[model samples]
Target: MSDRDTTSLLTPELEPQMDSLNPEPAPRPSRPRQMTLNMGPQHPSTHGVLRVVLELDGENIVSARPDIGYLHTGIEKECEVKTWQQVVTLTDRVDYLSNLANNLVYALTVEKLIGDIEIPSKAQWLRVMMCELSRLNSHLVWLGTHAIDIGAMSVFFYCFREREDILRILEMFSGQRMMTSYIRIGGVALEPPRGWREAVGKFLKQFPSKVDEYDELLENNPIWLNRTKGVGFISLEDMLDLGVTGPMLRGAGLKLDVRKTEPYSSYEKFDFDVPVYTDNDVYSRYRVRLDEMRQSTRIIKQALEGMPEGPWQADAPKIVLPEREKMKTQMEALIYHFKIVTEGFRVPAGEAFQAVESPRGEIAYYIVSNGTTRPYRVFMRTPSFGNLQSLGTLLEGRLLADSIAALGSMDFVLGDVDR
Candidate 1:
């Protein structure tokens, strides 16, 4: 009985042909045409040199991989070579958008190690003000570039218009624009300019209206709505998985903010709001940043009103550079300066991780000291680096063209990532 159909298992085509006498042609399998696209490391919308390789079928993206490190400058490794104090200059280049914030975090880390050096209350307040203002500047650049990418050109101009003022204020305090490097290890690199109060006040007075302009221009514009609303959408679950933070995560309705959750640099003294949103899309992100500027303004105003009166640097002359005036008259001051410049200060053996809410997200410094002038390892957990991790995830299944707005909204700075 088992041998009845044994020939049916024969692995011969000719033997099977006998069963049908004429075999119908086998059904052909369907294969969708694959379209490979290269969205550049040089493209304007990418915000920096980031090339993304994408596979698409029709308007849907099948897969995407972000190719970065195009702007690699080895800043992190270079820190090992620079002096603990000299490293401030290099910090400005990291998130170029939030240079002062970078300067503050690093300087503060090393400062904390210095023995019993008193950081004046005024200096701390100024630091908080500067850090918040830097956050606004960073968000401004992001909004302008991001809006331009999504076809909102006017918002770009309006955003930069205000950012120019912020840059001027930073320059007034530090003698430089984007790379202030003003926040020193002990305190600030320079004293606040005489008219800084009026200058910053005038700018703040006009800045709120400018934010409103951005809202009016893009908030309700039909084109802006169609392009951004519900686009480049991400969820809190995905954001948490990808380690996303900052406005992007908050826009997804997570009320987590480093400044509020983990206050630093006297941030707890400031009274302000942390804007949140339930729609984690380009439009909502725009709203979040726009409103964040308002919050930043409130902090700055309070800081200006309560501007403390004291020395800007830590009282330790051994670690902090003495003022040029004091160095000329005082022998002890001159010797301290000479020693710091020639031999450097000795940091105790320890490891500490310090995080600040940078413009893009959390900018953290993981510094290890081996009781020497040089750090054993200094790792920067740049916000852009963390934000960049969400790129592929946010970009998957999106339209090929939507990548521009999506990436723009991510506000990734290659320098931040490659570092």
Candidate 2:
């Protein structure tokens, strides 16, 4: 046989056998076969401008990637050029759920930087009363809306009904329902209103019973239980890695609370407990926040009962705006008010960090100044950003139904997350 003919015959037969022996390219690992679904800068499940990219295999979410910055307001950057006094106003928008808490943290930071201003005991205690009520207000919004997200309609109305009373009490004191920038650097925005004590006291008396109602409606309800009990469970290891705090951490049984650990705004003086759970699931988180609402009521009652009476704003003319009457009568008071409103107040060049136990978690502000009318820099360590990281981890392997339950447990406010 000719050599060329023999080679051609063997090439077709032997090439097929040789290719089979080379491992078939390992099938390219199948590219992992994930279906990516974008779940909102608009979807209802996200709760805000937060968009989560879900990588799924059928009904199970194999991975959840959180796409943030949709609601970024640049509130932090805007504060840098504003005077220290003006920055307090910016803090109000950071976490609207706990605006007072945000104001309290920022004010404390600026106050610490400018040395002590002799904040009155009355002012300090009033901050306590209002802040706890603020926490209760935040939880009500979270529970009601979260329940609504999960298809429980009753919790929404019930929680909002109580929230309205709290807001009314807030308005009586500061003349604003939600953004009561009442907490100032040296003291409150105003003295406790004439009827605030009675209003708050009545609410306080009944708020605990209302919380019991939330529990009655959802605690053991078969639908709620099925949706939340084991869904969105995040282990301690994952939580630590993700930097999640507040109810999310407590839900995992860590019992780490800034109020208990660091004790700000005279939090140590109050007798309250930080609730914890070992389950680390959606229901555990709901339970922890609900318990926090109860504890907050207790603290508020104590504050109202022992409420002190004194000057509401600080004596410092440089920081706090003088009274309107004094501004007209006294040249110095008038000048100080003009300077504070126009150029903002100056602080001694220094740095300070103040953290508060906000309803969602540890809300902190790291402030720095060059002793000028405006802040050199202002950075917020918001709780929502920390809590958002766990979504991907918690959502992985969860069914689509469980995604919402887990998201609700996070109690994320994109306003805070994006700020």
lDDT of 2 by residue, 168-193 (tens): 99899999998788898789888676
Best-performing candidate as measured by lDDT:
2
List, residue by residue over 81-148, the lDDT tens digit for candidate 1. 77788888888899888887899889877766664777889889989989888988998898888878
Question: TM-score for each prediction?
Answer: 0.91, 0.91
lDDT of each: 0.84, 0.87
Badly placed stretches (over 4 Å) of model 1 are 1-29
* Lowest lDDT block of 10, candidate 1: 20-29
Model 2 residue runs over 4 Å out of place are 1-33
Q: Find the number of clashing residue pairs for candidate 1.
A: 0
